[model samples]
Target: MANQKLKRWLKVAGQLIIAVLAIRFVVKEIDLNELKTTLLSANFWWLILALAAFLASKFLSAFRLNFFFRALGLKLNDWFNLKLYLLGMLYNQFLPGGIGGDGYKVYLLNKWYGTPLKQLIGATLLDRVSGVVALGFLACGLAIFGHTATALGAFSFILWLGLIFAFPAYYLLVHLLFKRFKSVSHTTNLQALGVQGLQVISAFLILKSLGVENANIDYLTLFLITSVAATLPISLPGGIGVRELVMVKGAGYLLIDQTSATALATLFFIISLFSALGGLPFLRLSQPKD
Candidate 1:
């Protein structure tokens, strides 16, 4: 028990350090005054739309997870599942060294519904994997359509091929390993696309809020890439630093204005933070009896 606790502590500490260093790197790369100006001048209406899109993405994400749950015979109602999902988000953002939002959900579901733990875990794991696969697919597709292909030359063809095969490969993996989830694979995958698509739209809105009227493809591509980066375990709660660092570097490579890129990342983070707070009210609520 002591060893496990120590390991968790060390992991959190390391993540915190990485998050700080990454933010520092981003701060050094961009002009702070320019970033501040951009942020302060952001259009409130666009920001509100971005927040709505982000919330919609979360709603779709909760619905997608429920599909996996239904596959396991849980059949949780959408409203209840959404509340649980938001609570999980809160735990995920605030409890890095704990059971985590997913683990907590698994524990609760097992206790309440008596589902097989293995299947519950598989459902959760597959839910995350499906999202990641979608993120990769979209990122690769964007790279092909954006300047990344031209920059990569020969390697761009590999990206194109990956984009074509990603879903098929994901389907095969599910059939082989997560047989129980195979039934809903198609539905969940489509939902994953919608979830990510809305997120990209949210990012685009954030850019518009920052007064970026053009070069949207590059910025959106970078947003997707940074999103993947933020998923790395080393990132802090809310993916604080990793996303910013990736945006700064990606902007430099793509010749985007670093200040605007930083502002966009920061705004997206803020919007996500705001959305996650929706789970706060459910935090102390009793587990649903239904």
Candidate 2:
């Protein structure tokens, strides 16, 4: 156990180091002043729209978990899912390891709701898988159709194909888990989440356009794909450079500039903030005992 923890720490440290190197390169090309100006200049309405979109995503996440739990014959409410997910988001942002967010998730539900350990662990895994499929579907769409995907297109397509094929097997997976590890169960409900982003043809374009323009179709798809991928157990702090790395690699497969891909990767973080923040309401509801 100690050795495993050490490895996880070492892996996380490596990711942070890589992220720092990437940020250094991104800093050289990204005009901080221009980026700031673009961010500040975003129409108030657009920000509102973005927040609305974020909330929609959060709600879908919670809703999906509820459906999945019910399918497994576990009784849970949307309110419970919302509160638990929100609390998980906050912990993931602040705490350092697996012992952080969802670890707290298992602790909370097992203690408060008195849910079986297997149900809590299994449900979280299912939630993550659904998120992956949704994200992959979006990325694949972008790679095939978006102009900039010249570099990342094939990567996205491959990922999309994988997710498409895997969707059917999710339920199968849960059954297998039940057979092998009867205590743990996986859920496969995605509720209704949407991915919407615009795009530009090139890095020069992403930098020149109003920063918030629809990500190029491919990039937009990549954003969703990466978003889903970020939820994986193997990830960087808040998925920092990992998102960029995936986008750049996938985008590169299609012809997207590394610099622009990096920039959009940053944008994905900004979007998740709203999604995370939407949980604030649920957080209020989740206040642990005084």
Candidate 3:
């Protein structure tokens, strides 16, 4: 127990150090005044729309996870599951050094429903994998259909191939490792697209809010790439610095304005923070009917 606790603290400390270094690098690279101006000049209505879209995406995400839960025979009410999801989000963002949101959910559900821990863990793991798969599919599609392909020159054909086979590949993965979820794989994957699509729309709205009228696809492509980086469990709470670093670096590569890209990343993080806070009120776990 002592060793595990020490390991957790070490992980958290390492994450904090990396986050600080990344933030410092990003700050040194970008024009702080330009970033401030970009943020301060954002359109208020468009930002509101972006927030709404982000929240909607999160709701779709909760629904997608619930589909996996039901497949495991742990039938939870939609409202109950959503509340649980919000609470989990809160735990994940705020308590990264301890048992994460997914860990807590697995413990609570197993305790409450007498479900097998292994099955619950698998369901949770698969839920996350589904989201990653969707992110990959959309990122690949955007790379092919947008300016990224043109920029990649000879390598653009790789994006085409990935877009064509992404889902089939995901299906095969589920068949081999998570056969129980195979029944709902198609539905969950489709819903995953909806979730990611809304998130992309949110990102686009953020760009629009910042008055980025040209090179929209380039900015969005960077946003998607940065998003994948942020999802990794290496950054500070809320992925504060890692997202900015990726956006700054990716913007330089994509020939986008670093200041505007940074502002967009900051705004999206704010929206995500607000959405995560929705779980605050649902933190007290309640026993749901079986």
Candidate 4:
């Protein structure tokens, strides 16, 4: 017990260190006064719209996960599933361990529904994998387009090749994950696209809120790239510092202001936190019965 506690503490410490380093880097690299000025001038209505779009994406994500649950013969009702999902999101953002959210999910579902551990774990893993795959597809599309418009070299050719093979590769992956529910693959893929599309729209709204007008494609593309980076588990507490770093650096490639990009990422993170807080009321309650 003591050893386990020590490990947990160590994990928390490590996450804190990483978060601090990431934040410090962003602070050092960007002008804080500029970031503050930009944020202070943002359109609150636009930010609200961005938050709404982000929440809609989470709802779609909840439905997508429940689809897998139905396949596992544990058809949790939509409301209950969403509540559970929000709780999981809370853990994902705030917990110390990399897989805290997913592990909590497996534990809850198994205890509440007598779900088999292997099947529950598989469903959760697949749900995560599906999102990552969608992100990969989006990033590759953006990269290919951006490179083609700006350059005509080997790097662009490689990106083109990646785009060409992305579909077939993704198709094979879908088949592997959905052999039993083959008929549902199309619907699931559509849901994934919707989720990602809304998120991209949310980013666009953030850019607009920050007064970015003409160079939206560049900013949006950079946002997508940072979105991909944020998916990695290296960042702590809602990917706080890591995301800001990615956005600030990515903005340089597009010649967008670093402070503005950081502000955008920071606002997105705040919106995410608010959404995650929706689960707080249910955090200590037992899982709802269907």
Candidate 5:
């Protein structure tokens, strides 16, 4: 028990340290007053749309996760599943060393449904892999067909080659993971795509909110790339500083202005951070009685 408490304390300390470092790096690397001005002048209506899109994206993600749970013969109701999903999001952002959001869901499902623990783990792993696959696919598509694709010239062709190869690769992966649940593959893939689509729209709205006019695709592409980076698990909550740093350094590739890029990244992070907070209330309550 002492060791467990020590581990929890260590994890919380690590989370705070990483968050502080990330915030400091972002502040040093970007113009604080400029960011403040951008926020002050932001189009609130556009930000509202961005937040809605972000929330919708989470809903779509939760919906996709249901496919995995059902594949394991677990029959959680959709509303209950969403509640579990939100709680998991809370655990993910707040309790990294403990039973994480995913582990929490697995634990609850195992306790309630009496499924094999190994199968629960596999289902969760496949769900995560599916989301990453979707994110990578969209990032590649932006590189190949987004407005900046022309600027990429022959490099676009290389991206296209990668995009073409991605399909078969994804199919092989699904085949391996879904040999028995083959029918769920198509639905899962579409749900994953929808989840990313919502997020891309959210990013675009965030750019618009920050007053980015033309070359919107440039910023959008960078946002997509940042989304990919956030999945790397090497940074603080939601890849805070890491994501802002990615935009500051990578936006130039798409001819985006560093200041606006930083603003967009910051706003999106703020919006997402708020959205994640929605799950906090769920943490205070007991599981809903089915």
Candidate 6:
């Protein structure tokens, strides 16, 4: 446990350093004046409206999670579920490892719901699998039209389609494998898995609406791939530079300016920070309430 905690902090430290460096590049590369002009020119109302959509997505996720827990006969309150979900995002956004937030969620599930720590972790892991698969599909689609030679060369096209198409196969295989493990929840809510896919898809839409343009098809493949990769195990200290770097790298890969990527990444982080604030109240309540 101590080792795990140390590792988490170390990852956080590394990301913070990287993020700070990335932020510097963003500031220097993008003309703050013009960036402001562009930002101001856009309709601010979409961002406002998107907030509602964000909340709705969260609600849907909570509802799906509720379905799973209730089916398993676990009793929980909506407030608790919402707060926990928010808190878990806090961990994901700020913690060092990709699973950091989910690990915290497992702890809370055990604490509040008295679930076996392992199984709670398992359930969360399963949800992540669904999300990763969803993102992979999008990335694959993005790759096909981008014209950039995939690292795989001539067979890259075939490989990309295989990967994009394999997400389903992977899920099916895992579902079957889990079924054999009697300890895993046989009553798994597959619907919840679908919800995970929708959530990522929605986020992509949100990014597009914000003016993140990827070439080829309408969306940015490099952006999706980089963002998903950065969100992996190295997100520490608000995902610090990791998210920004991914954005910069993604945008750069797609011929967007580094400054623009940096600004967008910073804006996205700010939004995430605000959303993460929902967890602050629960952090205060992290201590068991008698």
RMSD of each: 1.4, 5.5, 1.6, 2.4, 3.0, 4.5
How many clashing pairs in candidate 1? 0
Position 141, candidate 1: lDDT: 82
lDDT of 6 by residue, 124-200 (tens): 66655655565666566656666444444686677467565655575576667544322333323344434444444
Q: How do the residues 1-290 of candidate 1 rate in per-residue lDDT, one tens digit apiece?
A: 99999998899999889888998898788888888888999999999999999999999999999999999889898999999999998888777632398898998889888998999999988988888788888888888777777767877788878799989999999989999888899999999999999999999999888878877888898888888787778888778888899888888887788888889989998888888789999977566765
Off by over 4 Å in 4: 1-8, 147-153, 174-183, 287-290
* Model 3: lDDT to the true structure: 0.87
| Residue lDDT tens for model 2, 171-255 | 4765666443223333333242242222112221333333534435655655666666565556655676567667766665655
Query: Candidate 2: where are CA atoms >4 Å away?
Result: 1-8, 28-34, 97-99, 148-160, 178-215, 232-234, 247-263, 274-290
TM-score of 2: 0.73
Candidate 5 Cα outliers beyond 4 Å, as residue runs: 1-25, 97-99, 146-156, 284-290
lDDT of 5 by residue, 1-290 (tens): 99989987787677567757766777787788987898889999999999999999999899888888888788778888888888888777665532378898888778777898888887887787777777777777777656557767767776676667765677797687657556687898899889889998998888888767777767777887787777665566676677787888776567777788888888887887788777876775455576
Give me candidate 6's TM-score against the actual structure.
Answer: 0.73
Weakest ten-residue segment in model 5 by summed lDDT: 90-99
- Each model's lDDT comes to 0.87, 0.57, 0.87, 0.78, 0.78, 0.58
**lDDT (Cα, tens digit) per residue for candidate 4, span 1-290:** 99999988887787778879988999999888888888899999999999999999999999998887887788888988888888888888677655777799899889888988888887777676667667667766776656323643555566556657755676687687646545556677678878988998998898889888866766666776677677675667667788888887777766777887788888888888888888788788577644
Q: What is the Å distance of residue 255 in model 4 from its true position?
A: 2.1
What C-alpha lDDT, on a 0 to 100 scale, does residue 221 get in candidate 3?
79
- Which candidate achieves the best TM-score against the true structure? 1
What candidate 1 gets wrong by more than 4 Å, as runs, is 97-99
For model 1, the local distance difference test gives 0.87
Determine which window of 10 residues in candidate 4 has minimal summed lDDT.
147-156
- The digit string of per-residue lDDT tens for model 3 on 129-184 reads 78877887888877776777877889888887878888888899899999999999
Residue pairs whose backbone atoms clash in candidate 3? none
The better-scoring model by TM-score among 4 and 6 is: 4
Worst ten in a row by lDDT for model 1: 90-99
Estimated TM-score for each candidate: 0.96, 0.73, 0.95, 0.89, 0.87, 0.73
